[model samples]
Target: MSSSALDVQIKSLPNQPGVYQYFDSEEKILYVGKAKNIKKRVSSYFTKQHDYGKTKVLVKKIASIKHIVVNTETDALLLENNLIKKYQPRYNVLLKDDKSYPWICIKKERFPRVFSTRRVFKDGSEYFGPYTSMKTVKTLLELIKGLYQLRTCNYHLSEQKINSRKYKVCLEYHLGNCKGACEGLETEASYHKNIESIRDILKGNFKSSLQQFKTQMKNFAESMQFEDAQRIKEKIEVLENYQAKSTVVNPKISNVDVFSIVSDESYGYINFLQLAYGSIIRSHTLEIKKKLDETEEELLTLGVTEIRQRFNSQSKEVYLPIPLDLGENLKITIPKLGDKKHILDLSKRNAMYYRMDRLKQIKITDPDRHANRIMAQMKADLRLTEEPRHIECFDNSNIQGTNPVAACVVFKNGKPSKRDYRHFNIKTVEGPDDFASMEEVVYRRYKRLLDEEQNLPQLIIIDGGKGQLSSALKSLEVLNLRGKIAIIGIAKRLEELFYPDDPIPLYLDKKSETLKIIQQLRNEAHRFGIEHHRNRRSKGALQTELENIPGIGEQTIVELMKQFKSVKRISKATKTELTEVIGNSRAQKIINYYNKE
Candidate 1:
């Protein structure tokens, strides 16, 4: 289809909420999106200038549009998520997780066997979970095993087989792990009771099991069965201990799915915490690779739908850091404080930690990808037009108006380039005027780079507040480089970042990698500047001391320094040693001066 035909199709789209699919010339699905107003949203795709390259590519490849109108935004979101998953659109967020999570299955046969499996089949069996890890599955199964003596063997346990004595007890029955269900030693009613308790336990509701155990222990105690009572008490302790460890919030806040998202430029990590009876039963983090620079709400909405569907969750309420429309059937709660907020924060922390661990692993396994992610994150966080591949930071260093100097530290690909680091002595600016020194240093650094046609930095960080930033901007304007190069000022006290013509400073998350890089640059520049200033002060002191001597001159001191590496070595030198470098008269003058000191 031509652009004119595509436009006509978009124009024919309804104004109601719906899911829209974009198809390429080859009839392959390019993207899937949800919109409250189908026609307006599809039209905006052509009218607006997209910032992301993939979005622009997607728009260009869109040869035709197809949409399904829905009654509400929630329905649109659900429909869009399903279509994206079905078609696996190229420009839609990828929601596939290939890991086969473990699930605790209660077999559907007589005297059901409870065990962990990686696969789930529709055999009328009760499948508890697709847990995030095998360890969690093992732990839950162990707890259930300890609490109930359920059968582990797979036997038909038909009434005729048991009556005919066709099956016998196994090692599990002998070890007290099973109650000989195959031999009909355990009644169906008793076995089902234990299975019901296990079901409640898997759902994070241990009240019924605990109450039953307490009642059995009381009966055993009343019958003078102290050993049995002791065993029941131990089981109770174990159950309570596991419950305490799993419970993260108030017990009243139950049976809801909590989701929180932490996103970077390239990916979004949404953590889902399934809570039941105030305990976290399931925790999973879903990672979605962003294709069109989707917003947090969009990512969270899709992630919630996908994860809930994948886990077969029937949760009617969800707690999120931000409000979202997820159909009229699901209630969205944004917690502000107390236990609800704490759980929400916990979900966010899980997502954040998952993201950090992934980045760390990628850094070691794929350094290029790690660097790209950092660069992309920095570009987004700093709101730069391009990734800051090459950055320079300037810092002024002086002590009580002495030896005023500035240093410029270069960072390439988010790492310090030691060879490119430069230091400047404050020649044009006499006193310890930081702003003037910044202006002078900025002018000289870029002016020299321009003269030699060296590549300019993508960003310049001024290690001070607004005053230093304005000063650097003046130099950039003088060199006709203002607005061409991105520049920001970092205040030392608060680590606030100030941009040109923006009074309100931007405060990045203290733990953000971008802020860490900027802080690293600032600290490196400060250290570099201080080292240079200290050297200049020492050199000036040496000159001042030598000038005090009536006969000593700059040339004589220079010749003496040529023999002795430092003033301390010169002071310790013998007169004969000094005479070999300078003349006898100058050596005597140096010796006399040192002797007097």
Candidate 2:
């Protein structure tokens, strides 16, 4: 929090655009910000008589600061947003709800039925939503039903026909809304034709499809088909009205993931706008923890890298918040004027609004206490030359010599670096030997690190005691990586820690903030390792059983796996269900063979 410390930190920063963070002594982030010029933006905080009412009060508690320089202002904006979501800082505006949004689920039946749901399970179907507004999804569904004259009744058509009295037309039929299928006035071909029209509308081709419907209505009117023309006219009006209400943000660009970051002193918000074929698809908001004295550019860079690492795809062309320095090398663009500007402006406004809402919800006055304590403890206990900027942990998992897997999780300044998480399928190790698996994983991981000439972890924590520690040390020695990395082993005895080499494992007092943080990191690595192991084991078992079936080649097995996800599910499926997924002959063979017992 000293001016001298601030000056020292500023000397190391680049003059480029980026996002920055202010961290307390315990390494808890206090504020996040974005900057056009890292040096100027960060230095402004230390100047005397600056507009430092709230920031001045918060800055007094600051222990340290970190930054990430990006190629452009827009990239800084994105990075800032991503960081806010990752570390919900106390001073920034944040969105509270983390619930999954509702989506429209279409059951994979012979005749697919659409329904609105917030929950998505491993069921055989397709989901298309997470729509920002439920009203939009409902209106579209209603419009499709009106135009297509598809079945809206929940009762099964065949059951209704078989169990009920001789078929009688419903009210929709009388109103010309049913297509007269109940009265047998229309053939299956005519009904299916209407269904196809509905499908087109749902796919967002409303303009062209509506025009065709209008032409048909006119032709019917010219032919003196009064009732038919009236029906078609009504459907066309419905489509036009629906289109009129829907706001079009951009018509030129399709399938874009728009991002905007809003931050103040303590926290930030990253708003992700998903557009599909020039239409708004959905929006997601994430919160970030703020750093005290870091520049905006550094924060934004970190945010973008994290977002890109977590969510970017080859199919996406990222839009920028400001002009980038990467120039023509990257596909980032800052809109100067016109519709693109309008879109970016809208995104910025949304982010700002979210920030305001978040600021209002913050109740804490001084949020750096916990972070400072943890950092202090870590420094004292680890006997480090400097504070640990990046800590890496390793854990291995397997079940009785089957499907062994290892995971390496990275923590940069006391938080998980999801982008740096690595998983290894135990290849060099043959059995359930956790020690050997740990050794192989450790060797391969560090060997790659050496080959890539990357930074080494400040502290490496293994999940087991003496044996595991010995194995890791042996691997490091064999790979000529022994002296380059700092390593430790953490063994858990019920609720206690047993450290290797040290006769007494270091255990912080239960009330200590540092203990909680270290425990979180260790547990996360363990959870990650176990999850990876289970996934590999499950996939291996399924693939082995599936490959044994005759005529069920790898491709077919893959298809079946993609559809059903598990061998147990596939085994439980009926011939009819299997046929629907993989055709009749294969389904019959699978059903007969699997059920033969």
Q: Identify the leading candidate in terms of lDDT.
A: 1
Residues 69-162, model 2: lDDT tens digits: 9988757766777787789887654524334667776665434456778887668876665566788778777777677655444544453563
For each candidate in turn, the TM-score is 0.88, 0.41
Residues 425-525, model 1: lDDT tens digits: 88988777888989999999999999999999999999999999999999999999999999999998999999999999999999999999999999999
> What number of clashing residue pairs does each candidate have, in the order they appear?
0, 48
Candidate No. with top TM-score? 1
* TM-score result, candidate 2: 0.41
**Candidate 1, after superposition: displacement of residue 489 in Å?**
3.2
Candidate 2 stretches greater than 4 Å from native = 1-99, 121-124, 155-177, 180-200, 291-315, 323-331, 360-597
